[model samples]
Target: MTRAKSGKSGKSGKSSRKSSISEKPSITADSSTAAKPSITSKSSSDKPWPYAAGYDNTPEVLEPAPLTVKGTIPPWLEGALYRSGPGYEIQKGGRVSYRSRYTSNDLRERYKKAEAITGVTFCQRDPCKTAFQKFFTTFKMAAFGGPKMGGTDTNVAVIPTINFPGLMDDPDYKKKKGKAGPRNLVMTTDGNALQELDPITLEPLRLFSYGAIDDSLNASNLAPAHPCVDPDTNEYFTVLLTFGPTALYKVVRIRQSIKGPEYEPDLDVLAEITSPRPTYMHSFCMTKRYVVVCHWQCDFAASGVSVLWYGNAWESFKSHDPNVKASFYVVDRHQGRHVATFEADPYYAFHTINSFDDDGDIVLDIAAYKDHTVIGDYYIENLRNETGGKPPQQAMLRRYRLRNIAEQAALSYGKKGQPQPVPAQIDFQLDESVNFELPSINPSRYLRNYRYAYGVNRSGMNKTLIYDRIIKVDLDKIKSGAKHSSSATFWMEDQCTPSEPVFVPTPNSTEEDDGVLLSIVLDGRRRTGFMLILDAKTMKEIARAEMPEGTVAPHNFHGVYVPNSVAA
Candidate 1:
């Protein structure tokens, strides 16, 4: 993000011109080549700028960070600016060496400016650094996206979730209940990992129980996949909820009127879409009239396993026909009807829906082929059909755009320019380890209409290239589709695995900054989590609140941005 003309930019510009930019390198000439200078510094007709680039030792500063609320930065936050090296990258995870203290006080004004956008009320919360709650489930599939919900006021609703149990034979008189953080619920198979507690107070929301879906679960064929929310009608929905290897395929519609602060039970199943085989649907977004689901066609590596279902490969699977046309599903959430199924050719234009990053940007999962594993080389069709491509050896991020992809695919089929995709400027950065994972994105466009994106870097190293920085993208940029841009900024502290950051732009009133964001950071070795406050415009780290002792699930399925008035 570039600085505005008024403050930071102007000051930085003048300081840069006056300063002697280059630092005489404390260099030990490795060879005689350096001893014998090739020519002179004036070789070029125009001498390099006096401040030509070099390691300045001085902190490369962005505008002074906007101020955070007085209580925003917690004591647990490790300061920024560390000496790069050793004690940095540890086994369980990297150890934070340096940290940044609260410096810039302008955040208050910046935040106040941002607050001008929203017409809502919210609490000035000092978020806690812990997974407020955790639920275990038995479903074995590719991934668990953060949860989705809708409604407002004291009356709200959510798709409470938990990890699916494993081979453990623990049953209850009834079903155990837990709420996912939208995309909550991790199937760890370890009983101890489940946190059956109240999200708000961290008390026991319910007892974590496990058992068969039912005596008739085998015949019932159900799986609680993507539970969604309808804001317009204040209803919650999901595909069929089944038991056993909890990986369900057939799509059945379920819904209920969201009850405000009441003991309301889950909604009822209203419709069904029987597929030829199990077609896994990952994250779901929405349009004015329909829900957009990332339709995944694959034979799960852990399908029927009592132990490893949905835990296997996601990069390559082959269908009966390598190419019949694969695409995304725009289904009607109200009536459960398929509005339009659109597919993009892999060879042409395409973007696998990625999740959100720290700055509220999209962290796209690039190609069908993952390079990290044995099955890495396979492309999307091969991953779907089973036989194709070579694994790149672990997952790698692929850069793509919707417009370029749609146009490419259109031309491949002899159709062009009819209607090209105006993608938000969401580009994928190439990393060596872990193919970029998709993040959860909120569809609401306050103004420019940014495509919210998220991603988690599984690389163990703390390097910014390999990771050490969590990314967030906007839809406006995604639609703008800049092939390469630095706008998709990052949010990360030393050695912390950010589950997924939630963007909460403060409302218009007696506020402070351009916008403020809240996020959870799951620190690996520390066995804890923390809440982070960030500057929306610059994507700079603002403040942090450390979570209590506990290894919260390393990641989250999803999270929500709750406004104030109803937070009670």
Candidate 2:
């Protein structure tokens, strides 16, 4: 980690232009020969600008530089805020290939069979190129244009630039069959690996697997994009989804510590739970004592089968089954045991807000959707007004209260001595009117009963999928059925979009909402980006960190704020 002293001081509400730093070479890849769909901006002046189209054209790598500040950065505010997402876009006719030096004969045979099934040839001349070529070929064929591939009309076949560092040199690399190697960064929807960037510069550093540095940590098949951090212990908790004869979910805890001069984090597997089917889960919930994994009816096997045949993971999804019930797998954080499996009404959720124990019952709040249409609706092409398609199903703020969590776990045995599922009641439409996603809360309130939840809401006459407003919800009042329970909303300029809001608590703050909400806002009309800082309490703009002219920050899904002490 690198540290630099703060520059000359500037007053609040005034723009300050800092001297630019010397440019450093950026890590970037160019593959424009692949078959990707072209995006053209709409010509009509009456319509809102197509922001999603530009999403795929942003720069792949950014250099470390000073950003212009519109207002004074809180003098006490000291930390590196990190954001992660797909920085590079696979444009039309863009070709990308990957190779691994440690490929085995068995993998070669499997690749041959997969190629035969999809009629796509893998680069056999270079074993190092085979894995990525096969992966990208399947991805493009399934997502771009192919018979039997659904949603090909949307043209949303963008591949995240996933970089794996130092795997080729590992002597044991070939021994790990079908296991994802250690990566410095993985920016995909499936969460195979994580990428660490310079917290201050947001420059690509390297890719790493979940347990890259810890030998005691068990390898995970897939990693979650959103990992919850415990405010008290500063330990990060996330789930790793694995599949074989049966699907298994493991909850892992990661903690950072100083080893001499470098920061080394240790990883530990907290608990592993079984799922009957392979489910596509994007996020999970963590409480003080339990880690909750929700298995929706949305199964990955339904799509994985197609990848086996057609070579695309996105092509494997089946329609949502209303009759199928969603299952909640709760694991005891301390004992690392499966405490209970509770069932609730069928629904699909991409993100979870918070979960905690309320009088022996587990309460989980999520952005619940009617079905899986939201998955396809996120395609950049699908958000165009010319598509004339109905808006994707909005995820309503829903809460599920599982009664007798401990009691059900104790009496889980059935009459036949088999474990039976527990029942839970769910409450939907707590506010009825507010529909949003990408939720966040103050880090200190994580794993505890939180009062306020912040998230992004979309609005405009065009009704596109762009996020136009940031909303803060009062959980207590909303649960009480009080009218106008929403605390506040910070609306952006027309056509300007904001990414997910991350809450950074003020130093030694006692109040829950006494923090700052940080988000990267993209001015689509101007084709530029900036960081928007808002007062968590009043939802008012405190400052804005403007990017250099012509620098565009691509849309990001999630971000984290590491305080100065932790960052150093």
Best by lDDT: 2
Clashes of each: 113, 21
Q: Name the lDDT value of residue 43 in candidate 1.
A: 14
Off by over 4 Å in 2: 1-43, 46-53, 60-62, 85-192, 195-220, 234-236, 253-271, 302-305, 386-390, 413-418, 460-463, 484-488
Candidate 1 local lDDT, 1-568, one digit each (tens): 1110100111212110000010011110112211311212221344321111111111222222221132444223222211110001001122221111111122223323554211111111110111111111212121231122111001011122321211121122012222212111221111111222122212122221111212221233223323444444434433432223434322333222144222222333333333333433323434333444444343333342312322322322333344533344444445554433445432211124433222322233443432122222222222112122222233334443222332333343433312222333324444354334434333243111234544544444442122245565544553465533343566656646564444454454222224555555545445454556666656787655453454231233344443212211
Q: What is the TM-score of each candidate against the true structure?
A: 0.45, 0.71
The global C-alpha lDDT for each of the candidates, from Candidate 1 onward, is 0.30, 0.53
lDDT of 1 at 401: 29
